[model samples]
Target: MATSEKQVMVVGFDDHEHSAYALEWTLKHFFAPFTSNPPFKLVIVHAKPSPPSVAIPEASEILRYTEADLKKIAARVAESVEEICRNKLENEAIVEVMQGDPRNVLCDAVEKHQASVLVVGCHGYGAIKRAVIGSVSDYCAHHAHCSIMIVKKPKTKH
Candidate 1:
């Protein structure tokens, strides 16, 4: 079978539409071609940011938020991503939710999984905002260990 030489591919996911669209496009464009060539395994990764260091004066409130809570949420999000791709994907997909900087986390996952490609959606960041906040897509494009595909949403007519 073409699937004998299976390779791993990673897609950066969020609960948002752009992320969903990226997954759809990947399945349609990239994965569909897998049947003829070597089959590829898909992994959707979400890098959940850790809680912020806000100045909440109440120690009790801070105590209420635990690592377990964050991990639970991350697991739920991972499941959702898996659900999105379940129907169309040829094989079962792996959903991983990690905590850290998104760019670094995704890159690490690619390296760890030995993925052939990393797919992400462009958030339409303008020059100034991207300059200020440093776009994750931009960072991963340059930094990811594997090949990267940045899917941009087409502008809709007003």
Candidate 2:
């Protein structure tokens, strides 16, 4: 079948433990018994922060260095995601590194990929923290065109 014919599942990955857990959980629950033909096409998205616009000469130089560092981070993130998928289902996935706020990037990816579902890991932030920093999952739940699944890592036994 053509790629577009299959339902797409966009997974938000940020090189964080929570995101990794979400990917693992999704694979275990939905793609278990690893068939040659899974139900949905997996697409992992990593959103990199956009460089700030600074007018000062020194700031511009700093921004250039930061841009390079961001690229390195993106590469590492892609590699980690690939390793995770390889170890789990041995399945192939498209990994994209986008520049923008995660909430916007993820929602845009869903629209671009025509995804049927979007899976994101929750940071388990308190109300104040979530309000201040903002929650990507919460934003996506409201803005994304597809169904949103916010996976929260279970608390470890003390």
Candidate 3:
């Protein structure tokens, strides 16, 4: 089947264990049976913070350093994602690194790809922390224009 003809599944990813576990779980449950051709095309989306814009002479140097650091982080994220999906998927997963809040970036990716499902990892934050930091999964669940799946990492027994 043609790549464009297949349904798209957008997975929100980052350098976090929660997201990694979500991707692993997704593959094991949804894509394991069909090694040759999965039902949906996987697209991993990573959202990086936009660099601050300041109008100070000294800030330019800082901006340059920050931009370089961000680039390194993006590269590391792409490598990690590739490694995670290397053996699990027959078709290479599309990786997108966008600048913005994760909630907005993920929803935008879903729209851009015309995805049928949006998968995100739950941070399992408490009410206070969620209110303060803002839960990306919660925001996507409410705002995204498709089915949303928030995967929670299973608690390990000590």
Candidate 1 per-residue C-alpha lDDT over 32-51 given as tens digits, one digit per residue, 9 for 90 to 100: 66744525778889998776
| Candidate 3 local lDDT, residue 48 | 89
* Model 3: how far residue 33 lies from native, Å: 1.0
- The candidate with the higher lDDT, 1 or 2, is 2
lDDT, candidate 1, at 18: 84
Model 3, span 54-103: residue lDDT tens:
99998999999999998899889888989989977777789999998898
Which 10-residue window of candidate 2 scores lowest in summed lDDT?
Answer: 29-38
lDDT score, candidate 2, position 137: 90
The per-model lDDT (C-alpha) reads 0.82, 0.91, 0.91
- How do the predictions measure up, each by TM-score? 0.82, 0.94, 0.94
Model 2 steric clash pairs: none
What shift in Å separates residue 1 of candidate 2 from its native position after superposition?
12
Per-residue error at 58 for model 1, in Å?
Answer: 2.9
